[model samples]
Target: MMQNTALMPGSRWKDPAFWMLAPATLFILLVFVYPFVDGLILSFRPMNGGGALANYITFFTDPHLWKTIGTTMSLALPATLINVGIAVPLAYRLRHKTRYQKIATTIMTIPLTLGTVLIAQGMLSYFGPNGWFSQLVQALHLYDGPVRLTHNYWGVLISLVISGFPFVFLLVLSYITGIDPGLPRAAATLGANPYRQFRHIIFPLLLPGLAMSFCLSFVQAFSVFPSAVLLGSPAGPTRVISIAAYEAAFENYDYSMASAIAMIMGVVQLGVVVVVLGARRLAYRGPVTGGKG
Candidate 1:
């Protein structure tokens, strides 16, 4: 046993005389090791040479920082809920019907290819003061003033909803497809109604997946930057945490504070993940009867 243990340690990291370990070992260290080391150093360094704890302190004390955090969550949570609300029925229909699920999925998925920056730019042409929607409103004589959808909270919210729907839809749809179609059928055979079968069986099974989707969608909305900057007032109305981080890093040349804010954002995202997982656990334990999920 002693000899075997001695040989195992020597051979574990040894070069393959027979030929296999070098590439995989190098790949892991390169991908995970270097970046982690760099990020840790970057997170602590100040914007300038002398470190006075200015950046981190500034973020913690600023009311704007909290407001941005609130704005991010306000958009993220509601958008995630809305996406989930629409996704459940759509996912169900996709699996059972399959009439044009691919087409519908593709339509919803188009926004993902066009990034937030591109979408923001396009929105200006379609929804801005001199844009088509504005002209339509003017033709209808709806209001004397220009419609304010392009440069406000609504624009940012709309951009997020457009970009984030497919993410929730596809995740839920994949989960729904994996569900045994026969299970719902079995419940129906035993005299369970459609809604009751879904409530008692299908929905419980989906809590974990839906919870995961919510976290992902929430993170996506919360991290919005290009759309908020281009389509809304980052300094005035829709300044999200990500925008604040970018400004810190680039505009003010405050890398340390930017990293600090980023770390804070990471904490919030992690907290959200934990909260969702906890809620899912609690939800799954309940009587799978009738709840909004």
Candidate 2:
């Protein structure tokens, strides 16, 4: 048998593959790791000169600060669920080549190009009390009173849905398309109906991708700032954790407190991600065959 020199302890460092990872490792260190470590350290140095945990104590003690976590989760979870729920069926239907596939994809993806601020401004113009939506509702006599959609919780929720759907849809669409079409076709041939084929053959394979999509969408919705400020009552019902961190950093000029709050925000996001990924482990992990299994 030939000896594997590349596996040798001292010779591994001379491998080209090891050098190929240098740029990415350096980039990650500079872009993600360094900032996170620095912020974590900064969070300990409270401006008021208390213990290392002073900022965390203040955050937990104050209702105004701690309540933002619940508020953010309320918005993030529902928005993520709606996006993923809708995207699954839609992506399934659009997995195969169709006449309207490109057109539909282009229309759906248009929202991704629009910024959060622009979407918020548009909602205010179109969904405001006296705007087109309310006017149309009144014209059609859908409701007796003014249709209040903007500057409230509903407005923020709508913004999140509109912006987040495209992302989830695209991710799910890719995952669905990557599945072996013959698997579903084989199920169909074996007397399985459409719903049965989907549930038994397709969904198990797609669960991992869906979990990842949900985590990403939840993170995007959780960190919402401009929409809450522009379209919702930031001081009251729609106040998210990001707003609290912003106030601590900019308004109160408490970098340490802001860093602490950011850390908390990261922790909550990480918890949700961990739960989702853990659940994904129970899903199917078979090979993704290209119809040749």
Candidate 3:
């Protein structure tokens, strides 16, 4: 008797679509899952051959190591806020097609192409103590002394902004444009001014995207190492968590400690992401777009 192929066990595996996921699955397993598991295991293995918790305990007990969290947060939070704050309004303004929109976007994207180290170098030249900005200030008699911008907190902060703002802007712009133009127009027809329309409609729809953008920007800023070392005082003000992790792995040749620090960093970042994503649920849960199918 002939059996039905459709009813055969494991028939679904024969389909091409089922096999199509193989590459991505293999990639994730090799690249992400394997590394994460390996790192997690390594974090528990201390170099001094102590207890499983030795790495974590040492990280917490050492004031110098623990303090990197606060330093990273100080820089990350402000930079994320500044980038999102600026991107939102600017994105809202540029959402609709305009003559200068392309030009503006091109200019904004220039920074993204320039990596962190290049941006730090450029900032050092432009915003350095005796750089053009300081020279211009002096030429205009704006200040008696040279303007100090690099090798400090402000230097790192500025570098973060320059590198981060483009990402935030593009992400926010995509969300804003996805919104139906009719929503704002309808609000306008109802006697709502531009401000009121945006307040009632645009801003509400943008919150979810804003939260995501903030999380991403914060992560980028938090992982700052090149900028902190090149632009800011790495040994003091800009000694971020990445620097601690780097020192552990490369400088001190302690892979276990580095993995532990990395795990902690991931946990902190995950916490912020979870909180922001949770808060997003409180916003409008309807379709992101105003248009109907």
TM-scores of the candidates in the order shown: 0.84, 0.94, 0.94
Among all candidates shown, the one with the greatest lDDT: 2
Residue 247, candidate 2: how far off, in angstroms?
Answer: 0.3
Computed on alpha carbons, the lDDT of every model, listed in order, comes to: 0.80, 0.92, 0.90
Error of 2 at 41 (Å): 0.6
Tens-place lDDT per residue, model 3, 16-123, is: 876888888999999999999999999999999889999999999999999999999999999999999999889888987887778878988899998998899999
Please list the residue runs of candidate 2 whose C-alpha ends up more than 4 Å from where it truly belongs after superposition: 1-3, 7-14, 283-293
**Poorly placed runs, candidate 3 (over 4 Å):** 1-8, 285-293
lDDT of candidate 1 over 1-293, digit per residue (tens): 25664356656655454246667778888997776566556767776644656556677789988678888887778878888899998887787556598787788778888878888888888988888888899889997767778888889888887788888899998777776677788889999998998787788877777888888888888888888888888888788899999988898887777877887787898999899889888777665433222
Candidate 2 similarity to native, TM-score? 0.94
Give the alpha carbon lDDT tens digit for every residue of 177-288 in model 2.
Answer: 8888888888888999999988877888788788999999999999999999999999999999999999999999999999999999999999999998998885646763
What are the clashing pairs of model 2? Answer: none
C-alpha displacement of 178 in model 2, angstroms? 0.6
